[model samples]
Target: MFQYYCGLRSGVKPNPSSKRSSFAHKISRFLKCCIYFFMSCIVFHGIIVLYGAPLIESVLETFLFAVLLSTFTTLNCLCMLGPNIQAWIRVFSKNGAMSIWDNSLQITTMCSIVGAWLGAFPIPLDWDRPWQVWPISCSLGATFGYVAGLIIAPLWIYWNRKQLTYKSR
Candidate 1:
């Protein structure tokens, strides 16, 4: 019984599945993701600055951390089980191919951006309280928007799946 449990029965060895990538490969891919993350952060921060959002003493630091949140939201939406950065990149490309997942994520990302922008409106109201800081409202909005998107995505995909028609590329 002990030998059987230990798999010592007949010169048998447990082999890992071929579907998994090697650790080295995953690390390399993750490093590439890091570079993309940094670049995207700079771009997002620059746009925010250009739009005159706020002038925090630590604006760069704030953006550096906020980009992490944004990336996490976007990437997880695109590929929850196995993250495909390339797939997310394809969404921004011209004449890009679209799948149900791709369509859902793209819409979700846009909704999140809009939601975040909308969240800022409440800050200027008569409620002069403590939590009305710049970008905080926007961040909260983005978070809520992403959650809403997550909730809506499955239903959207399921409802539209049958209606989706193929087009000649």
Candidate 2:
């Protein structure tokens, strides 16, 4: 049992002279995929928000919210999935893995969504009538988003550490 546990942690040698699991390669690939996906999403979202069709500004705002929600949900699911994937890799490739962060990001994201919805000002996009609505709406929306992220980030970090400590015990 101890040897198996050690094997899972240390993993198998890569080459006859090197020590690294094939699982490490898979993990690197997965990380790369995630980075690519995240970057692409950022680029696409930025383009839609900044330079979308003039008439579609309102639609873009809503679509942005939906995309953010989906991303948050997906990341939350990944936190849960990590442990299972680690277990599978441990068995198949004799490599142990653990996720560093808990699923506290989900909570922060929910809180941010609620804050945005209930903020004193609402988000809007009116490119045609900039003087009429765009400035005020964008100002308020950006302020709300910034404040929400600030508040949620610390709480998330604290909650994550607390959960990790509790689980460790």
Candidate 3:
């Protein structure tokens, strides 16, 4: 089922002529998605560390946070855009004009980042709650933001679906 959804996002139309070929294609795409997911996790981990996440003091938490953030952004984006760097660039770096898919990616990415940023706020506060630990609050915030994006992006696209016209550059 997940594979089917991924295939749809990556524009893998069903080939009525060959079930064997279709199965092979889906397996290959699924593998590619897994690879991209893990690679993005590592990249996000390094990025988080650079952004002041602890390396020596709390490696596990940092890595877990990376996984959480990656799940929100990288995994979701991969499912939407596949492994095509060109598609990523087109959606992420091009003009504001976008298809529903591109807009969804942008919204999800922004929400996750903002969520993580906002999550860090309580860390320095003197609230002294158990959830105030380094990345706990941030993770919760990111998760909430991601959920919000998932909800809002669709509604936003639906509300504006007719107004925007996306052209391939």
The residue-by-residue lDDT of candidate 2 on 1-169, one tens digit each, is 7545445556852353333565576687678547644654565455435643244556655455435533543444444454244443442342122233333443444454454344413324344554334233433443465467657666766767765566556
- The 10-residue segment of model 2 with minimum total lDDT is 94-103
Give residue 151's lDDT in candidate 1 (0 to 100).
76
Better of 1 and 2 by lDDT: 1
Clashing pairs in 3: none
Name the candidate that leads on TM-score: 3
Each candidate's number of clashing pairs is: 0, 0, 0
Winner by lDDT between candidate 3 and candidate 2: 3
Candidate achieving the largest lDDT: 3
RMSD in Å for all candidates: 6.6, 9.7, 5.7
Model 2 residue 142 distance off true place after TM-score fit, in angstroms: 8.5
Which residue pairs in candidate 2 collide? none
Name the regions of candidate 1 deviating beyond 4 angstroms. 1-23, 56-61, 72-74, 77-86, 93-97, 165-169
- Mind giving the per-residue lDDT tens digits that candidate 3 earns over 47-166? 989988889999999999999999999887888888877888888885643677888889988899899989888898887899998899999999889988989999998887667643
What's the TM for model 3?
0.79
- Overall local distance difference test of candidate 3: 0.85
Q: Would you estimate the TM-scores of all the predictions?
A: 0.68, 0.37, 0.79
Write the number of the candidate with greater TM-score, choosing between 2 and 3.
3
